[model samples]
Target: MKTLTIRRPDDWHLHLRDGAVLEGVIADTSRHFARAIIMPNLVPPVVTAQDAVAYRDRILTALPQGDRFQPLMTLYLTEGTDPDDVAAAKESGLITAVKLYPAGATTNSHGGVRDIDKAMPVLERMAEIGLPLCVHGEVTTPEVDIFDREAVFIETVLDPLRNRLPELKVTMEHVTTKDGVDYIMGSSGNLAGTITTHHLIINRNAILVGGIRPHYYCLPVAKRENHRLALRAAAASGDKRFFLGTDSAPHVDPLKECGCGCAGIYTSPNTMSCLAHVFEEENALDKLEAFTSLNGPAWYGMAPNEETMTLVRQEQPVSYPSKRDTGAGAITVFDPMFPLHWQVVE
Candidate 1:
């Protein structure tokens, strides 16, 4: 097996929650990603330029000493989001993009946009400022089946948004279905998508094969086997439009195991190792560099990181954290679908 080394990768999307939980989990991410687009769905939400700056500072302070990880910030889009605030944050470089979460769609998303149509003013401002809108593309309608939420979202929300605001740039975060891949490939230039590590490695069966695995349950939850195959194809196609975004969200073990579990997958620790295994399996190891390193920066209109990291194909079993002591009792670490045989060579 050939050993591969390339520029350090950037996680285009991540959730490094604030306070003690943030302190406990930031290191695993810093060890792997040189930078990451920090999500803004905090309890109150990072809704303004000031909020973004303060959050960025907290992340910087939380980073392990001597580490050079940069946390790119984003604002949570809401109905009342000020256009000037969006433009100011982008201009000041305090925020890189704006995230639109359909209210009630995901964790701590109650403060998200209630009506997408009503939020066109904010979208228009984003387009004018050249700030990309990263979206949690599932609709929250009660009538939509859980499995079909993503596809339904594309038909109802994304398709209309694309047509209405043709100039607006958007990134569909953590896409898990064939429809998502096809839509992204079809839209090519104006729209792009971020495929997460867990989505690429597991399908719905992995969640229900033996029992209901809560760790495998995430927003825009894993799709059917055929969709999983489609996602793998897109990632290995050597396509620049598809790239890495770990959406490495963490929840204390109790929150995940409670009656109503939180929606997120903590994959920071094994992200790159998992991706290496997937690409190698597809015989697309040659294109892994572009997917992990080149594509994310290109999509964000930034330069690829100059530093390099290496990975070797070796069989090793890494332990999953049963509980992380994040000030609370413990937060559970998510397990990717299979045994990871490849590991990053520090």
Candidate 2:
């Protein structure tokens, strides 16, 4: 199919870091996605309804003039989070979901939940109110090898939590392993996963095979090639349980290039193009809309976007900027390691 049209996609997960970084990168996503479940892991994190609102306002202010994009706010889940405030945020429609970072799971997550028991009050409240909890589904214990974290998290953390509160809706953000895909596919309800653009395209080899490629490194780091295939199959299967969450995390060049580099891949700029290439390769291009546009909103209890975007495949390879200059520094855009032929018609 040379030309395809679908509803403007919504990113089930995104990170528009606060301040200058946010200002610089907001447009990259806003250009394609209609809405996004904006991640709350800022410098201090958005842990309260007021914080979500303030952060949402900042996102809106940062949006390039005339860009019609919605930032679905979320609270950073902390042990001390007030149930009443979360419920109020829901009632007022100020926040979309609550985020769970297992303290030190990823960047700015040192403030995350250390003990699940300590967070029961908030989690239980969220269950009662039918609010979603987007989890960074990985165990942080030191003994577990980095590549094994996602599978271990499924066995030790996620399964027990789901059994304990079947009513709670949880999005296993950035499912990098087949274990994650199978876990979500086997679930009956209230469990879904978001597949990232880079995970669908690259594996652990992208990071370590040819020296250290910092930009390819991300939390719950890419797994084996077979896992990437599982993710690809799940995404292109038209399964309601899996959808797009670019997880387009941006880290400045210096932070990524240093000895103790950060974990993230910035894919916002060329996500749609990369996705189109993937779906086309899978011979499942017809299912692209379901994965990118329809499933996420339905899972989040909203209607799919009415607006549509058309992608036209051209003979010539499309070119995207390798670096995005933010006020913070130059952030590297994800290199898919292949030429993209699909272009979103402006």
lDDT of 1 by residue, 228-320 (tens): 999999999988899998898998877888778888888888888888889989999888889889998998999999999898877566555
**Candidate 1, lDDT over the whole model:** 0.88
Provide the overall lDDT of each model, using Cα atoms, as 2-decimal numbers: 0.88, 0.94
- Which residue pairs in candidate 2 have backbone atoms (N, alpha carbon, C) closer than 3 angstroms, thus clashing? none
Return the TM-score for each candidate structure: 0.97, 0.99
Worst 10 residues of 1 by lDDT: 315-324
Q: What is the lDDT of residue 334 in candidate 1?
A: 63
RMSD of each: 1.3, 0.7
lDDT of 2 by residue, 107-224 (tens): 9999999999999999999999999999999899999999999999999999999999999999999999988999998999999999999999999899899698888899989889
